[model samples]
Target: MLVIGLTGDVGGGKSSVALLWEKEGAHIVDADKIVRELWREPEIIEAAVTRWGSVILDSDGSVRPQVIARLAFSDVREYRWLCDLIHPKVMRRMERAVFASNRWVVAEIPLLFEVGVPWWVDFVVYVTAPPDERLARLSSARGWGEEELRGREAYLLPREEKIRSSHWVIENDGTPEELRAKAAELAEMFSFFSEPIEVTVSCGSEEEARRLSKAVIDRRKAACVHVYPIESLYWWKGNVEEDHEWEVSFKTVLPLYPDLVGIISKEHSYEVPVINMASVVKANRDALLWLWEELSGEPDNHAHRS
Candidate 1:
């Protein structure tokens, strides 16, 4: 599986790139969603309330993010304490997310490096812009002053470190159209070198599975397909039993996922089927590049994205 981690400074246009990836049919796991979900962990929220006092709470009794950000994002000790509380949990979720993203998964994590999670990624794209540009963008978007911007900037790892650590860099000081074009270009380039995929599929004694799996792989619905015998343990009709089954796995470029799903549903034997895709965990670089070429859908297929 190719795991690409995307990160950028505030107002650096990371979302634009993620959106572009989505346009070409890539799955995106966003860290912002993770953090929002984390706020619902009562113990963690209670601990924060106790540490920072209750003004951080809203009328709905949820911890207000702005209030929490004010406390934890500015004061180093407070920020470190919050990080100590949240970073580990976030990382754990990130691990699950990466694994869940079968094939090429693009994760939009804003503070990916600041939280020090780069090692988990196969490729990292650090989005950046000049501080002045960042401040200008943020001020226009959030009505923040220079001091506020500096405070936000200071808490993050320096820009230089972020850029130095990345395999690719996206500078966001240009217009949205420029950003979109650049992002499209980079995504195409990355896809050009991605490995051709392989997949494993599992199915209940449904007669259509073998044919379906083979057809999907044969037609490039997914890059590769594997069928295996599976012994499943579960409860049916309030009784548990072990049942023999066939599992088919598919390795395919991300773009073909929708079609893959359609085929599995249309052909699988089970009335209610299991058709979940898993991200590729690790793969040979040569295979990856080949996959990339097909995924990019370059005009000539022989031509490189660049």
Candidate 2:
């Protein structure tokens, strides 16, 4: 089965791209939709009422997301606590879909890497939109105050990190047509079955971050996708504190790292945002190489790599 994970920051228009893929006839397993189902579970409501108290629940004993979103986003630990409660449930649902997919399947996994479930997918695709665009989009939609906006932003993995680790970057900053064009390219390529490569990609552009990721995976060079935020730390001339700018980490393969790095650097955002690299410390045998080859556009045999 061709299981692909899709992720993007808030307001990145990932759903828009997913629709384009749907038009092309891929089955979609939506993570957010599954999580929404969990929201209706009595256990979930009980947990919320216990933590945030009974007021968050409606008169009928249902959880009101807006209430929870406000309370949860107000604190990182609380938000994480909520994620801990819901993520596993979401995973179980995703697992069911993955097993059931007889043909190409697209799973809308907002936290694929964070939850560490991308390991099951043949590929991962991250949607990309500029941070300003994201902020603007959110603002226009909700008419939020600074505090509300910041709270929402705090819930997301840094965009820079998600973009850096992706295998395919669907730029959502453009018109729907532009995004659809990118999605089509991905659908065309994933039809291959030569196995994948494992490689780390330090990419600047969301497009490049994923392009290299898919390329390396398709090439069968490396396995496992590690994405983390790399903040540029600098001290103002006389300030004791250092300012943090963003960078991303991609852990893939030693052999294909150089080529991927070049492409990432060329496509990167910062004049010198680090396109960092690292080897996979541990991974499943065939799956590891399958990742790198799949991303690198040079699908190879997974058995030989092992």
Candidate 3:
């Protein structure tokens, strides 16, 4: 199971990214929702009353989040007190929810890094958007003033540090379609929608096939390459042609298919290499592991995308 902690600046579209993950079958545990529940808890209400007296409470005697925020943000000690009072309860609920989730769990923790909860996830995905855009979104969506937004944002770590700390970064400063595409790409890493690829690349001769096979395997492009002698019939230019050929089948992960195809084309003698690939819907776990381990040697610059 893969546990991904999703976080971002307030109003940076982390929830939008999380919705895409949810569509891909990820069990989403929203920390904001947990906080909302915590706000109404008797213990939290009592704690707020004890700390700030009646001012932080509503006429109905419940703790008002906005009132608490207004008081807490003005003083560091008050802020810490509020966090200490609520964070433990939030963590307890988060743990219970996560324990009952599916194989792919995505917890949307807006203050994931602030609360130091990244350590609990397999990896953290930080969503990013321009400050102007984020401020606009927050103002329009939640009716927060610029000063109010800035005040809360000031409490968090720097944007650059958050991006650096996270294992993956998703930029949400684009259209919804672009964001969805990036979301899908990131989803592939968790193997939620991942499938094996069978790549076919033909060679002029058995020697050429063996050389191609060896090169790809040694380079960790393919876990297993099978070279077979075969007769190929094809239409070239204006005439149908038949000749002896060698077929090379590369068993690899879907993510490596494009690279594998490029490698085959670069090594092939033919001007137009017979490169084709199809997804393997069901494959043995050991075989999949071998392919993954081989491809793991490659540098993952795309792992922490912006």
Best candidate, lDDT = 3
Clashes of 1: 34
lDDT of 2 at 115: 80
What TM-scores do the predictions have? 0.66, 0.61, 0.66
Model 3 C-alpha lDDT per residue in residues 10-72, reported as the tens digit of each score: 888999988998887788999889999988878778777887888987788777777878898
The global C-alpha lDDT for each of the candidates, from Candidate 1 onward, is 0.73, 0.65, 0.79
Query: Worst lDDT window (10 residues) for model 2?
Result: 192-201
Q: After superposition, how far is residue 298 of candidate 2 from its true place, in Å?
A: 11
Rank all candidate structures by their TM-score, best first, as comma-separated numbers.
1, 3, 2
Model 1 C-alpha lDDT per residue in residues 133-220, reported as the tens digit of each score: 8788788888888888778878888887778877678777788897787777766656534433344556666455578777676666
Candidate 2, which segments miss by more than 4 Å at Cα?
Answer: 145-147, 191-306
lDDT of 2 by residue, 1-306 (tens): 467788877778888878877787688899989988889988888888889898798898887878888888778899899989999889888888877765567888877777875566766678768877877877898666656656676677677776676666677777777777777767654433222223333343455555555554454434444444444444445676443332334444444556666655655554654444433323453554455355555555221110
